[model samples]
Target: MKKSLPKYFRRFLLACAILLALFGLSRLYFRLTDDFRLSNITYKMPYRQAWEVPEMSEAQRENFNEILNQKFYYVGKGAQSYAFKSEDDKYILKFFKFKHLKPSFFVDLLPSVGAFKIYKEKQVERKNRLLNSVFDGYRLAYAIHGDETGLIYIHLNKSHELNKVVTVHDKIGLVRHIDLDEVPFILQEKAKTTRTVMTELMNNQDISMVQKRIKQIFDLYLLEYSKGIYDRDHGVMHNTGFVGDKPIHLDVGKLTEDDRIKSKEFYKPDLLRIVSKFNIWFKANYPQDYPTLKAFMDEQMQLIFEDERV
Candidate 1:
């Protein structure tokens, strides 16, 4: 017992040392990468010292206006973002809504930094320019007037042909799978309050289609997230849309939690949540086919609830 106590104490001290080192590095990164001085300014969140985006020049404003004035097809929205693409087929845009944030936002965001605390909130307006640039399909964002942050990406106008829509549900395999508009109402509103907005995404046909798309999504998801080059908030139905059969990411944000699925932590729980979504989705969309979906969903639910011992 005496020896064990000494060993445990050493392990605790080591853990503390690592945490302190990380804390120091995070602070350094925050101080060095702080772009408040370099970027333009916009309206701050409801109550905070100053978390804002850089100001857009007159030219950027004109581009913004040109895009806004024209009509476009709605892609979908994520927790705090809404997306659309122009009719002329040039780019896709995503708008991020930043709600409540603290002054130490940066310190609270960026992994090595305030990750110890949850104060960062959205950190939306943070230089997403650097972040979006790191990935191929991801486009950089710009601060519009003051309402929200805008992200513009190269548009792939393939899904434009999908006129018939079906909501795909993986609800415990009873019924089946199957598969929106407006700055548009979707099948469901994820969050009711202003803190988070509902998200929607475009997909073709039904459950089978989403299943096929899953393999592709997994491929791309593994590619980007594995390297830690991109902070994929973990993909979801609404966070991804189809452009001529290709999956496109609809939302952009930072996930600083080191223990997240894509991070060091196991990703199964996150994937299981999606599976559960399939259950609820199936129950809602295809009641007749739901019983058929039970076994498949049951297997998944088993992994989620029963397989933990493995």
Candidate 2:
């Protein structure tokens, strides 16, 4: 029974309450209509088997088909794509995620004039550009570095082999049926990230093993550079991983081909970019071992830099 709030303050509070209610309702409307909107957004790209690897045996192809036949469980999502694990857990199917794929109330309310129209058109253009780039990257990665990148196939268009409705258990355990032929996706062999492996080794206090693994990672980068293939965003911890004893780049979206990368001008900067994050993490968590590893890495990198080809 305390004194009542001022009339202006009460009105402001009421206005806020009304705004919150409206916001919640709008969210509910979008959530309920998302699937319908997504269905109407069609993505069609040409089907091309431009390159094939003879090294990929018939058995491997058969195994890949078998995995596709089974149900997939959603794993996790990254900025670029949504990952779903095969039933056997040996492979992953990644579906590209697009921005601004659905109509928005606010955007529709605009009169479609001047800068607003330009902004809308640019957004659509960007979405298409991103989709094409990722598709090409997968194709290039398979052709140039399939084994290292673990890319088995790119299904960019509808195919009879993948023509069927399939079950998928999503991240929150919700079950949904997905039509494979209607969706474009990339199939890749799943592997543990470098950071995961390094953390384990560090926990075991196996400094020698950690050093060995880091050397392999460095060697992998050098090989890519020698081949004129470069990963522009080379975050070793997240983008590179271990497939058996070999280190491979997991994220192929940013890879590009340029012989200029092998030049002296690009060598040290590229190497430093790749190792920067790893160095920070090591220094923070394993300070006692950081100096030794840093010295070893520097020696190894220097040798690579001095190579005649480089």
Alpha carbon deviation, residue 267, candidate 2 (Å) = 3.4
Give stretches of model 2 more than 4 Å off: 1-61, 100-112, 307-310
All candidates' lDDT scores? 0.38, 0.74
TM-score list, all predictions: 0.37, 0.79
lDDT of 1: 0.38
lDDT by residue for model 1 over 87-124, one digit each (tens)? 56555543332222223455544563465344343444
lDDT for residue 214 in candidate 2, whole number 0-100: 89
lDDT value for model 2 = 0.74
Task: For residues 6-96, write the lDDT of model 2, one tens digit per residue.
Answer: 9999999999999999999988865643322224323544555652234446787676667778888877767667788888888888776
Question: Residue 82 CA error for candidate 2 (Å)?
Answer: 1.0
User: Clash number for model 2?
Assistant: 0
RMSD each, Å: 20.0, 5.0
Give the Cα-based TM-score of candidate 2 against the true structure. 0.79
Q: After superposition, how far is residue 248 of candidate 1 from its true place, in Å?
A: 2.8
Worst 10 residues of 1 by lDDT: 180-189
